[model samples]
Target chain A: MNIDAVVDFNHWRDQARLLLQQGIHPTAVNWSGQQQTQLAFDSPPATAESSRAYAAGQVPKNFIKLARAAACYRDESRWALLYSLLWRLTHGESHLLHLVTDPEVKRLRHMAQAVRRDAHKMHAFVRFKKQQINDREWYVSWFEPSHLIVPDTADFFVKRFNTMNWSILTPDACAHWDQNRLQITPGVDQPNALIQGQMSDDMDKYWLQYYRHIFNPARLKTQAMQSEMPKKYWDNLPEAALINDLANGSGQRTQTMLDQAPNDPDRLRLKSKKLRQQQDAIRSKQYPSNSAPDQWMN
Target chain B: MQLMDKLAVLADAAKYDASCASSGTTRRDSAGGQGIGSAGGTGICHSYTPDGRCVSLLKVLFTNFCIYECSYCVNRASSQVRKARFSVAEVVKLTLDFYRRNYIEGLFLSSGIIQDEDHTMEQLTLVAKELRLKHGFKGYIHLKTIPDASPELLKEAGRYADRLSINIELPTQQSLKMLAPEKSIQGITTTMSRLQAGIDEAKSQRKNRQTISNRRSQATFNFAPAGQSSQMIIGADDSTDGTILQTSDRLYSQYRMRRVYYSAFSPIPDASSALPIQAPPLVREHRLYQADWLLRFYGFSTQEIVPTVGPEAGMLDLHIDPKLAWAIRHRDWFPINVNRAPLELLLRIPGIGARTAHKITRVRRHRRLRLADLQAMRVPLPKCRPFIETLDHTPAASLLEQDNLRRHFIPPVQQELDLFQAPPTPLVTAP
Candidate 1:
């Protein structure tokens, strides 16, 4: 880049600093000034000493200096710094301009990707199961998020279900809702192990049956289907356990599941076998005996 | 077909119109419904922005094939554009696919008047029916009601749709007739009236059901639970701001519309002889929106907003916003005591939005707020300064010199001749 053609980089840097000091991001700064500055000289490392001092709880001489320096750069880099700073403050970890990891790090990396997807699922799925607990009713939902979304997702749950007493239990963290006063705590590795009694069983069976009933055979696009409801979550979802059997020998299983008797007629018992029969009946009614339509992708 | 490609074209086409709102509804998932979703009263529904606007749904026309040729519509029948019609099953499939992918929450389905309005409307209604009844889709669905469609089809449309909209085409009856010769202002208003009547009937039915059936009303006869809203194309016809507001005022008063969307008319793909080659200033649409908000929320009347007549007199000033224009014109009203001003007067202050005005009112109850408290609340003090008198601050009484203060607000900054000239030194610097 020709230095002569370049406008004053330092001037833009100063302007950016002024903007940041005033709590403004210089997103709409003149493009000419931006093009002029060489990255090495123009993009100053703000005041490292002041940042260090401020982080250590010492009053720095220039409180606004760092913000100003942050503003001086083009918009993208400024946002990058802001996010990096926020990440560092929250996680107490910083590795700017570098990437290094050991063999064991790959597991965590994979886990992180899974967690990201699960966070999205937590946002997407995790249907609340309404139940009566001791006269005061509440909605209980169990979501096995891949990662730690409890901190973020709790706020959403609180805002959305403010009127109801709800709890979103996950493997890593369990969120409690008492009339919208929400609190999250790190919990046991698996929530399924902790869930009490026949309620979970009945709920799981009901969900599976509902899923089976709604699954349109004609709309099943394999790649698209898997993309939305990944194979990874199949284990946790009870509906997936019956996928192959239902797909291949749906009618037979329907009869066999129906023939099984009710162990406890007096009580609200886990009628998984009966529910599976109902699912089959729904399937037979919707698609009939000829062959499964096999197209339901939604 | 790749859903993304279809979405790109459809969503892009839908973006030109501003009528996809999913609020002001009271629809929810039914028992044994495969999915659980809700549409509540808050108009805070989602929207997408390919250009930074919110994307609420996969808004698209069922087909851009129409019988009536609206001069300003890109999808007008005479325009030579590639047209596609999604089958009932196809539309249902597409909505489910898009929704499942988490690309959108629902569908905002519109169509050009194919064959006839009744024929097109029935097809559109069928798509909603499948989404709700056959598929048990609990996602939000907004169906555009054709103005000439039967009251029966319109009623069925409301049963499934979270929201329904009827485009008024243009502001004034004269403009609508001149531009869209086929479109009847009476037809548009009649549809709106039918929708409102249906809504009232549903509300009564719901009330009656509460007394009759202790159980939740599964009446399924609910009329546009999200409520009916209409859209007007700004700058398309020779409609003045006064005319536009008067029309909107009537729509709100008569049909009880939830909203009156202002769509700035973009030139048709194939321009008609009557249509302008150039697009209207998008800012005019924005101004209309602001004006509409003032009417609905800030308690401004049509007469107050566009009181003057003449070619330029009756319109909103382009440079300054509508509210700011009002404040500048009505200087006698301001220098209002922030500590003591009523909610109505406080709302009239430029840059002090409804939220801030409410905040000021609330904070004043506990402890009177000084200028600092208002500043902390994020109220734009620069504009507010001319209007409000706090404990620590007051506008110079001389600010009532209308022209002088108006100039200050707009700021007499000299536009650069080219790029080289230096800005003149400031005459006076306010501390």
Candidate 2:
């Protein structure tokens, strides 16, 4: 294995040829002969009659083809180096000095950026249920991720809920804690069960009721809803079973809600005004618990 | 009749107008009494497309009825199309319903001139006010300003709407008189001026960075926080590409519009004897869009693009995109060194998009670039090669021969089936 060494171009070319001979596809090696050779070497200029030249018999010597061969290898460090070199070569500079100073490593580092971003969004948005375990307390939550992020993301939950026992389970990974540091594991499908030490049915019931109450029937766009909370996550949420019934009977429920209207206009007005303020505060960029750092320097 | 029928009639009538974008402005909900949403002071809007078409709005007209006869409009009073008007309450209910369903992010309400400008503007404001004060909606709202509405009423409309827009109606003031005789350019410009004043005042106060309560008194006249946009009808009037671009330049310079929409004229029913029998080819609309893009994103100027010399000059080529056409016409600008060309020069080349330009700038920071390097950057090397010079490439000057380049741009004659192919030979001969 090449491990972490930054292989030079000549060594890469020789190493790649050996690996290819030993039954590895050129794509599988860090210094694949294809891209390494192209950036390490040079493409002959197309003839002055290049416009008339077609590709049927032309042996392809383009840098793009070479870059793709390098990308086919999964080693990110090699890919970053290759990309940096490829970029420099394309911009009219034919020197290797450009690759040495390129900051293109950020792209390699951020390959998992989307996964991390979405995982944080899930953590912020997910509402957990309370269950009593032998008269103590525990919270249960479920999530569906577009990619595997649970292994790294579970630390956030562990840090936040260190004093309370909790579990966050996803399709691919899970995190469990006993009021201490978190233990993460590859996920297997497991049904929610009452814990022996600290699970309560009353807390679960209260949370479920709150969920039902807050759901707005007025703004029920299924397509928009799906884009935010994908259908794949439906089975894991406690409110999932209630969704169909709520949607189908939305009009009736809304009518019922309207009928139970508060009579004291001033009191109702004050409460609603307060609620709107609170909602605005939560959505504001300055909320103390917001995941992202403050956008404005102030 | 049925809601579906109402939607079809209204949406189809509205489709001729291309000002459906729901961007700019981020307002939080402020209405009291247990409402689901609110339009914040700032306008955070949602457009329609996944490619970032914002939609924080319920963009529909309050009515399609009109008193004045604008020839380009489907809802002009003279047209025989069925018309419908939504009551203030009904419009509110529809908005609330759509908002709850989350099909829309907010409301963009416009209307045909009914009764008079004051009455229509008042009604439109009521929808925004009701959605704000009554329903307590906090989503983004954009309202179309009435050209002759009372300043007080227009002010109210602005207070509630996240953004405001006024259609310039057509490209040229002369075209406006010819196509829409009832409307006056002076009236439209006056309202735009007033709205601009309001926007400028609010912006100045906001820049002071005072609290909302402190700013509220200073914000006595709330214009569109998201700013304003306008639309121009293409092909309806005999405005040339040069004239249209010049007007867009003036609007951007004068009114500070956030965006300008170009709505291609669709064919009229039982078309007027004065109107052309066939609409301008769709390609004309596409070319106008390309030209507009060039003006906005590319560094091309109105005069620079239209030309001062040569035959068939001063008119955009209907066959090729404006940038490509410009590149083909001005071959002297070729062989720009991609490694060292300024961002402005790079933007002039076809197939080297803004993103690719940025990519090129970023990638070239560390190394010298070559012909093969561009292909890796995904720059359209085939199109760009003729214009750019890299370490590995230097094309012959014959690459710019007018005939050769023109052949590549304008497809084979079999492809250009014009809209009026069946018109009498004599009609084609007309100027």
Candidate 3:
């Protein structure tokens, strides 16, 4: 018995439900993507009586949530694993998912965690470039996520950037927002030519300047930086180009700062006094603290 | 100066502050507003600099022109660094631009005393006000509160900003007086106390409104919904880790601070003869953070982590983490049964974290846990082996009593000779 290609969690859940209703064991059904020998036996048709007996609500809510996340994982074995867990939960092992030490449960948990982490990284690393399209502004970005998470993360981008026209292009799928609705299309191999050409904008220059100066040469932790912002994502990041130069020259910069001589204390005292006197004159105006509007009072 | 140059100078001046968190704010998004931003998820680190500091927010000072000469500050009035100030409109534009590009979480605007504390505080608050009220921006905003600013200004700043912070600058009042002559501990704490009162009042009012409405409406008043946090500069004066942790502990309990950042004093370009020329080791700051976590989350007291009457008094162990150090000192508490121990005892184990400890307790309900089970859960066995007892494995009676137990956990010294030799060839390389 072979199932059709699993497109997403919904597809997988529908197929798994049919398999469960037909009383087919998880091992007996071969998901289409897996490279396994075909089973010789044909699966019996699912019946209404079995379906009524194993209604969707009978499974714990936690299993559904975990299954949804685990199904997003890129591994081919996920469908079988999820089905096994679901089958056990309905077959008198209702407490199966709660056992963290169980090997199958642990495997599912790890896969779900990986999917979540991939989505989080997508949120953090996506860089949008501004472009002019037909006298209107559009923000475009090119990202390569590790899993089928483009659809899952579309709502986040839409909610945050609803006022702007933007598109996130990825190899698996692409998400676009047009102020009124979100549209997802098939994946692209390359970003639009306009986005590629306009990657380096005036804002990127200022961003690079901010990044260079904000770094503290006195405390260099290259390993820590690499762990969080790995080298794989550096090619797309404008600020990452300066990382090696800044890290390499940090030692010399710190030494130069140390080599500078201290200013004269007597002159410093006089200068400080002069500044204080100047500030006192300005303070004489006594600006009212409540001068600003209190719109938040309501 | 150009906006680019000012950004370089002001950002350099502001890098000394260690707090870049943008989480724990009220959940909001620009769904129906005229802006394009959101907040209130786990804080996102858009980038990390080589110093390992997260660039979660566009952290910059509004101005570097100062009227007070703090000995440790780069922007002190007496320092020879270039001075620059951003107009309120300029800051608003910069914040919006950066946020739209997804380059930052939001703005963390601090300033030096341009004319006086009140003027500087007002300028800082106006940036947040412009962002929230004019643009309807829902992104995170953190404002640095001037200690001597009036209460009304503080209240206004809290209303617009998600988080507010005032640097304690030093551990004790004496040190603050000696170094930052114009700033006082009383002024800082008094402002913190006022912020705390506002936060509490708004919280209770929100509770009452929720009860009255019997619904979780988004219209409740928010006053620094992320609450107040503060920073203390370590090694600025001669204050020890003991004194520093004690100050943080006090701030946590007394003022209800959400966090207390410990920044190691780094070298400034214009040397201040009154302060040290060299910066402390970065590891010292890391150890202090670990010890701080034990205080807040691990149910450990300040005295237990750093005792008062010892040769190593007032100092954290520079080599090993504070948790392992405490575990070695209190050997009698070891051999805690993994399956039967309470959450608190499980948390005390060297290798088990809060999440892992909770997982252990939950797993043990169905079946007794063994050493292999812990390994399967990804707990570091070597670190907690002698301290924890499992169903299948237990440490010998003499293992916990060994005098050399501390050395076992300390990472072995790196051998420079190995680097000169050729690396060992892999027996089987992956295809």
Q: Best by TM-score, which number?
A: 3
Fnat of each prediction? 0.01, 0.01, 0.64
Residue A27, candidate 2: C-alpha displacement in angstroms: 16
- Give chain B TM-scores in order: 0.90, 0.86, 0.94
TM-score of chain A of each: 0.43, 0.46, 0.84
Can you write out model 3's per-residue Cα lDDT over B1-431, one digit (the tens) per residue? 78999999999989999999999998888886358798999999999999999999999999998877678889887788888998999889988888888899899999998766788899999999989889888899999998678999998999999999998888886787678777766667778878998899888988899778887786767799999999988877888888889888988998889999999998878867778765776778899999999999999999989856556667787667788888888999988999888999998999888899888887888899999999988999999999988989889888899978876776555233334543223111011
Query: Which residue segments of model 3 deviate by more than 4 Å?
Result: A33-41, A45-52, A192-199, A264-266, A276-298, B215-219, B414-431
The CAPRI-style docking tier of model 1 reads incorrect
lDDT by residue (A198-270, candidate 3, tens digit) is 4545688888999999999988999999999989888678788899999999999999988899764335656
Best candidate (score: lDDT): 3
Every candidate's lDDT:
0.59, 0.58, 0.83
**Model 1 per-residue lDDT tens digits across residues B57-164:** 666777775555567775654555456666688678767654433335578888877656789899999999988877667668898898668888888898888778
Candidate 2, after superposition: displacement of residue A268 in Å?
Answer: 52
A238: Cα error in model 1, Å: 29
What TM-score does structure 3 among the candidates reach? 0.92
| Reference-based lDDT, residue A197, model 3 | 62
Q: What DockQ does model 3 achieve?
A: 0.39
